[model samples]
Target: MPEIRFRPKYISFDCYGTLIHFQMREAVEPFLIGRLSPDELDRFIAVFRTYRFDEILEYAPYDQVLESSYRRTCRRFGLDAEAAAIEAITTAVLNWGPHPDVPGPLAKMAEHFPLVILSNSDDRHLAASVPRLGAPFHAVFSAEQAGAYKPRLQAFEYMFNALDAAPEDFLHISSHQRYDIIPAYDLGIRNKVYLDRGYDPELPPYEYFSARTLADVNTALGI
Candidate 1:
């Protein structure tokens, strides 16, 4: 076993990009078909992600966030946004499985620590995704439960309150700087792990251990 540096009271995670294969760009690309060049589609995906993040600044359903962001992206690119496309996007999320690296190592961690999830997702969608993770979670929290999304202090606050725990009691792991890691650090969660999924930049000021995969995190924890 590796040296155990920290043993948290609970191990919390950001579900989407960290554990689950967040395939937003993959899911939306087909909709862009002939409307955008390859380079423009990449920009379109980035802008759509921005809109989704912006939409969640305040309380709203994840569906609304997706719909509004998708429409805004299409409108920005002068393309037509259709209801079917919105429906397809939402459906795709329901069917997404965990990243190939998640299950085995997550299960190993779960053996020694209570695992939890604080996701920027709806209960229905989260429900569909959790069982696919191949591990038992102590608690699974969603934006629907918190009435807020990641990067928002309210979401983290809600998780802290629900667990009746303080920020110091948990090890929060995530791939997103703006969405999960930064807010967590600001909220005084000293122990954080950045699962570098390549979607966001790494900022060392936050003082987090970086891992390329869940197995790396498990090894770091001495599991």
Candidate 2:
């Protein structure tokens, strides 16, 4: 892990998984349990994850993205794609809680820095999810507002434009390296935190420090 070298103008976060619970697996498992056996279930899950990643390459309504991802993933695994199942999983996003360790430390971090969220969610959905983080945010930006989604450069460009801030001005944090870290780094944001929520493995030359949890930010940043 590297040290947090500069005090940033803003501390930006990716809401899902990094701060919010991001229980996509929990929300979708009901649709697959009886359909696949223990062996097939594992491959089904991997494919689903892959499909979800594929779904974000273009801008679309978040609900449509979820439905299309699920439908494509299901078809790949030789399963029926039910619209109601997709609806259930999409709706479940609103009720996810914070990671158990999130609230207290994040609230403390907010005291020392201006907090912001750059989420790949719809406006109405983020309204319900953001409050669950238990800290007041300086700004909460959504894909619905930005008209783009992450792993795509336009998404961050939209966010940068909205915050009226440049890449180097903030310390961006996220659990998904593919979604946030690579894009942020390419855009000239050097100060970054890779929160380890186990979505992807870390690699060097990625140009960011690592933290196991939100509480570690205090010590890592010398706050």
Candidate 3:
């Protein structure tokens, strides 16, 4: 385990994969069932995940991201893509519950340091998810408000400006390196925690603390 000291005004999180399971794969599994074999479905899911990441990097709206990623993944899999399927996946994201370990540790940590969420979700969508976190947030920001998505420097700047804090004032925590850590590091956020959920292989060159669960995060903070 990596040793880390938590000393920040706010501990910011990437909500989807870090705090919540981010059921994108689960949401689409039923639709893909019987349409493709298990092995084929795995490949399709992988491609869809990559396409979704690529779409967000272009600074498009989240809805376009879901639609294009669905179409591209369908093309890759030789399946027909429909707009309703994309809409269903997007709706599923908003309906996702927090990870089983999230609510308790998050509530405990909130008592020590203010908690903040920087999610790639719209205001209306996040309205449903944030309360399920079971902790009062100091702030919750989204790509819809920022006009850009994660891995973009502009999104981080929006959060920093909104909170009136410097990069050093936050201990940024996230599960995805490409989506969160690399950009955050480049933007001068040094105290970062990689909440490793196996979204991608760990790249130690980023020099971030790693935790397997939110309980691990609380322990790392000495709480």
lDDT of 1 by residue, 1-223 (tens): 2344888999999999889999998889988878899999989999999999899998788888899999999999999998889999988999999999999998898999999999999999889999999999999999999988888899999999999999999999999999998899899999999899999887999989888998988888877
Ranking, lDDT, top scorer first: 1, 3, 2
lDDT for each residue of candidate 3 in 118-198, tens digit (9 for 90 to 100): 988778767988999899999999999998899889999999999999999999999999989999989989999998888
Error of 3 at 167 (Å): 1.0
- The regions of model 3 sitting more than 4 angstroms off are none
Q: lDDT of each prediction vs. the true structure? A: 0.92, 0.87, 0.88
TM-score of each: 0.97, 0.96, 0.95
**Least accurate 10 contiguous residues by lDDT in model 2:** 1-10
Angstrom error of the Cα, residue 67, model 3: value is 1.3
Model 1: CA > 4 A from native: 1-4
Winner of 1 and 2 under lDDT: 1
For candidate 1, report its TM-score.
0.97
lDDT of 2: 0.87
Q: All candidates: CA RMSD in angstroms?
A: 1.4, 1.2, 1.3
lDDT, residue 9, model 1: 98
